[model samples]
Target: MFAAFDRPRISLRDAMAEALTKVPDVEIDPEGTFKYILVRVKDGDKQKDIVRGTKAAEYHNHIFDKVKPALEALGMECECLGGGKIEHNGKEKKIRVFGESTAFGKAEHSVSVEKLKTVFSNYEITWSDDKK
Candidate 1:
């Protein structure tokens, strides 16, 4: 497999930005703690929030901002990521973290969700259900 930075490639953040730009409704939680896993919002694209000046993209950026570093610190390979829709609201958001399935558990998901809740108001663990 190719290495993470085999060709004097850019820093992790730059690489992440480039990748983030490729998705439809994507954002990196600006206040998130996970470093490697580029989490994105998975829902609300079709909701009224879109027309109500709720930039789904910005929300995503906020999410990734908050979670990535901690996911990385938990021994989760940040660069190795796969994500999709889960849930969302003005305060709480949820997204599925996909990978080799062997890496995560429900408790890990709970901790991350709780952390996000702390930063975002009333951001309750609406659900922490990442089993795969």
Candidate 2:
């Protein structure tokens, strides 16, 4: 009875071949470990999060607290629609202005563009009308 229990086991090559024939429930790493475990982040509604990265969030706050008021004081209707990113000086820079307004006329638009350029001199500003 002990002799029967000592029968030869399957070879490593043969065992690997057999395992490859069936699809596994979880992805296996090369080291024979599970690829990912306990995912916590939900994929729903990432817009707010994407728009609120560190620099962008700070810029957005500044716009709301200071820029908007300054522009409004100059008789320009300004709206803070949130923040985004832009390539400025060959580097990625976060922007605080991503809004639309019917308040900007031809002269006001030019003036506002100039004012924004002065305020954010280091950044490359792209306007809605494709003016930079």
Candidate 3:
């Protein structure tokens, strides 16, 4: 009867496993292990809508136009990879931006399709990484 009333004991390892849930952007491999983690923010459908019109071009330009001065103030090295304006009906509209940066770069600039859906809170987002 007394033993039945005792609290269940949890090992430190078990406690850590449970605690990991509170941390975001963590990956556990098939073998259930990880060495490091990375976090990044990405554009979503809302971002696309914001970047797909002449108005968007102006807004995005205004946002990035501040970048050069900021970088200069910080004395950071940055480079533009390559990007260009997109046109739908033969008028300059929208801008696609890409860049290389020492401060932040990822070899696999990828987000799990499922993860993107969750982050954007839009189930319509879809992608596939499998090559068949």
Taking all chains together, each candidate's TM-score versus the true structure is: 0.26, 0.24, 0.31
lDDT of 3 by residue, 1-132 (tens): 699659898976556444333333322221211111123222221111011112332332332344435433533332322122221221222111222223333212133323333434422333222211
Which segments of candidate 3 are over 4 A away from where they belong?
A: 1-5, 26-37, 40-101, 121-132
Model 2: number of backbone collisions: 0
**lDDT score, candidate 2, position 7:** 89
Candidate 3 clashes between residue pairs 3 or more apart in a chain or in different chains: none
Q: Candidate 1 residues 26-120, lDDT tens each?
A: 22333322322223322222110000011243333343444546444533323223222233443334433222122221123333344345444
TM-score of 1: 0.26
Report the lDDT tens digits of candidate 2 across residue range 1-132: 599779898976655445333212111111211111111111122111111112232333432454445434533343333332222232443222223222221122233334345445675555443222
> How are the candidates ranked when ordered by lDDT, highest leading?
1, 2, 3
Question: Which residue window of length 10 is worst by lDDT in model 2?
Answer: 32-41
What's the residue-level lDDT of 130 in candidate 2? Answer: 27
> Which consecutive 10 residues in model 1 have the weakest lDDT in total?
46-55
Alpha carbon deviation, residue 33, candidate 1 (Å):
19
**lDDT, candidate 3, residue 2?**
94
Which of candidates 1 and 3 is the stronger one according to TM-score? 3
**Steric clashes per prediction:** 30, 0, 0
